[model samples]
Target: MAALWPLWGLSPGGSFWQRFAFWADALDPLLLLAPADEIRRSRLLLQNSGKTLSEPIQDDQMRKAFLLSLSSVHPDTDKIIPVLFRPPAFLPICLPLVIVSSLHLQAKATFFSQFVFHSYTTGFALINGNSTTKAEEYSVQEKQIFYSLGAISYAACIGAFPLVFMNRYTMKSPLMELIVRKLLPAPLLGLMSAFTVAVVRSPEFEHGIEVVDRNGKVVGVSQKAGEKAVRETALSRGVLFGTTFFLPNVLTYFVQRAKLAKTPRNLAVVRMLFTTLVLGGMLPASLSMFPQRGEIKRADLETEILSSTEEPVLFYNRGI
Candidate 1:
């Protein structure tokens, strides 16, 4: 049997198969299955059957041996619930889930298709009616609408043009085709979503976001603070999407490897359901890491709004 993992990290073995095994093992946390017992069982079975799975188990032939042994281990333990019947369909949407559960503007995708493509941004002025001179609050919602329109209006321009260029009467690898047709769309949307949020919210930099004093009274606005806040929001959105970027592809790979689905559509449905649940569980923890109302040192403020005797605390709403 393979030895226990080291205290530090996954140990790199001397060969490629060993490396692949290590990564495959790494994927279990994301898979939500504790694989230690199953893996050990597979190793023991192979050994008992007179198959040598050495410290360096580098043979391609051993791949089938390992899978055969591993196949005996059940992935699901609960007999009471079937997969589809475990959850409802369509009551909650991914976009809003991506928004509220997001760690901020970062994880929320502006999607256009099952491939999750297309987006645009708009600028809106949010002016406080109470203030004598209104500071136009940047219209993030307007920006999203414009992004949606742009995605719909020029769908061919963005998605098709590149695809056409990639396939332009020339032959390409199957991997490249997968990248162009399937793997590429979601990350592209993610990048566009990040870019859109940053640019549309730039108005915050000009008008400055409202910074409150220690007592929560609105003092003079700070453009620098707004820039910092917006930058973090944009970055968090990128981080949110980062872990999920390859999720669908990875799920497809594992499902295929296990032959889990009865058909293509079945595989797709299972992948989607898993993605939704995994993301739902992840969102709350990610968002909870940072406070919605962020704090800053009063001394960091560009505007000297705080009095000499005032406390060294200030606050701003870090938007989702």
Candidate 2:
């Protein structure tokens, strides 16, 4: 009974019929009837014994089977639910959290477009350039200035101009529009995103971000190594924007020409929904692909940082 207490939230009512209905609704488009089987087994165990389903299963095999049947359990997590899915995480509930008022949509979009680069640069400088590393440091004002320049340029050239000019693309071929509106802007924005990071953090390359030992003590800094770190971070940013931004737009360009989007209104709604889903899924996965804490070899460092330590291994932040 104590063990199954957490699953009550998946159920909607007090009795068997209610529970069945709850499971039915919750698991709509149900995969393999897994939820139903798990619930049935729990109800069977809870029967006339007057014990709640929360009681720990006395049978080891049965308990293992019951746990493995859970919908929320991940295969790699020893069958336990991930912390991100737990009640306190507030995610599955929060996906629906959005601004429904269309009047503010353009404003919100512009704000985020500008904020994203600034936020990325700030974090990049701070995390990669630890508190004690003056060589890697940029003042908050300097970072803001660089971000504003880069982001405004990026937003104007890659973001706004295309939207304003390309709304009614005159290109006869759908493929041409895909190349012009989707493929071109995506990679360009990606390059500009990386450019923003590099410009905002150019000083770090001249100096260096902190390097650390196994003891968490600062070893020394190397400008060459800093260049590599910034380059990799910027490249990753560029690739993310290119893949996530361009790929879906290209797909939608072709997809909109299909019979499904025969009407202009239908095509517009479909494009908006599809683009939202693509960005939501792609951005996180792409950004996470880069190694956060990059490794370097003793041979790669400048002689000063090299002579300062005998340690063969060094680590630095590859900022996201």
| Tens digits of per-residue lDDT for model 1, 81-108 | 2211111111133433332222111111
Best by TM-score: 2
Model 2 TM-score is 0.54
Give each model a TM-score.
Answer: 0.53, 0.54
Q: List runs of model 2 lying over 4 Å from the truth.
A: 1-132, 135-147, 158-179
> Would you list the clashing residue pairs of candidate 1?
106-237, 119-147, 120-147, 121-143, 121-147, 122-143, 124-139, 126-136, 126-137
Off by over 4 Å in 1: 1-91, 95-161, 169-172, 306-309
lDDT of 2 by residue, 1-320 (tens): 22332332222334545434333332322323345456456444533223332343456544434333333332112243333332212212222221111111243453455344434433443333322245323464466466556654564355444444545554437776555544565666666667766766666676576776644456776677678777877776667555655665666668776676788777667655655565455444443454444568988998888889998977665543
Cα RMSD to the true fold for all candidates: 19.3, 14.8
lDDT winner: 2
